[model samples]
Target: MSAPGKSIFFMDLARNAGWCEGRVGERPIYGSERLAPEGSDSPAVFAGLLRFIGGRLQAFKPNLFIYEAPRDPRHMGGQTNLAAIRMLIGLPAVAEATAYACGVLDIREAEAASIRSFLLPPRPKGSGRRKEGELKSDVFKQIVSLGYEPKNTDESDAIAGWLYACSILDGRVGAAATPLFSQT
Candidate 1:
């Protein structure tokens, strides 16, 4: 980590066909469209993503890297959803590739729910759902709130995750705060 404000990178692995990775620093950067290759999570795909991730790390030189992990199907109210399928199917390769990257302890995992919780406004009175917004919409708003307009959904998710990790690292979201992820 660098000083009290570590530069951060957040990767939201493919929820469909490709993944999205974002870098945050003095100036936010998101060159995520090329991070994922065709054929999903094949070994060759992983190899390509590795080089891409490494190159981005070298270019941005972030002090910390955080990625979204696949959701636990058991926690999805026992219903199989497309999001879970894409995550379980497409992300091991991404995680493995990232873990094998630079020697520095720059990588970590931040659950999507955790990031949302940290960024979401309090639940509206008498309503379980967010007042009048979609999660992605709010996340995008937060990215804008942080002063960056994300280029894509993956980039948006990454930015949200980066903010969540920043809150934890910067002391806004502490140990008493809702945990960032469940036990594996």
Candidate 2:
């Protein structure tokens, strides 16, 4: 159960998107939604994503909504395919538009790296750099240690983002003074 007021919703958007919903001092409920079939065309996939976001917005009625900001393909070190690049770029735009249409105006985005840095411990002085998979595993372990069972990496990532947002909203960490843009 969550404390009263200041509910938040966090999402990690993708074809198999993950979401977490909770209030300030509570355990969030999180799970993933497959937006469409594996190789569906972009329009169909996006339509499914739109409906999912809209429905969740209405059902949860959260005070603030946050999602992991998608990284650009260039920054992905050439490992991502064109199809994935398109989906990653388009998902947030669809989510934001859906939130606006649903009258949930206080939307924000946090970079995956930022969430990682906030939730995971710093690397030890002489341990050499850890790979991305290692970091993700550490994050999964951390969340599990906190007594949450995440079904997959996507859900864990959403939980991590939610944890980061909760830290900021609870005054444990400082967020940027201004949002990306104001609705008004």
Candidate 3:
């Protein structure tokens, strides 16, 4: 594993067909779009997004790809439900295609679920929700030298993955500040 370039390429996908704003701490980063065309769940749309990301990734030839995993497709239905099924179903295919197209690895969190845990806290017993935000605070503290809050959870998670990869590349994790958000 190698450190991904400083220029990271990130994309988020929701199961429904609408865009949503994301926040990394307090900063807002917007770029959520449905891969599929209107009223369609075509594979081409997912393939196209992967191609677009692949093109953007060419500049740095990023060693990593941080993508948002999709929600369960069955739950995505109706006007109120904005999740895009193509985003979920098409991600694995897109990741494989993108990695082949770019010649660099696309690290999907779902493939190795524990690989992403460097940035998340353990889920509490009997609680279905994972403490990702709590883990984010821990990571920020650990990477104080980086000196910036990610623009959203995706960004935060991506940064954590990057840091974890960096540690693997460099053979050590750099010292980080204890995040102010941490409970003393």
Runs of candidate 1 with Cα error greater than 4 angstroms are 1-4, 15-25, 34-41, 76-93, 96-99, 130-133, 172-184
C-alpha lDDT of all candidate models, in order: 0.60, 0.82, 0.46
* TM-score comparison, 1 vs 3, better candidate: 1
Model 2, position 127, has a per-residue lDDT of 89
Tell me model 1's lDDT, rounded to 2 decimals: 0.60
Best by lDDT: 2
Pick by TM-score: 1 or 2, better one: 2
TM-score of 3: 0.49
Top candidate, metric TM-score? 2
Using Cα atoms with residue i matched to residue i, what is each candidate's TM-score against the true structure? 0.68, 0.87, 0.49
Q: What is the C-alpha RMSD of each candidate to the true structure, in Å?
A: 6.9, 7.0, 8.0
Off by over 4 Å in 3: 1-48, 64-86, 105-116, 120-146, 174-184
lDDT of 3: 0.46
In angstroms, give how far residue 14 of model 1 lies from its true place.
0.9
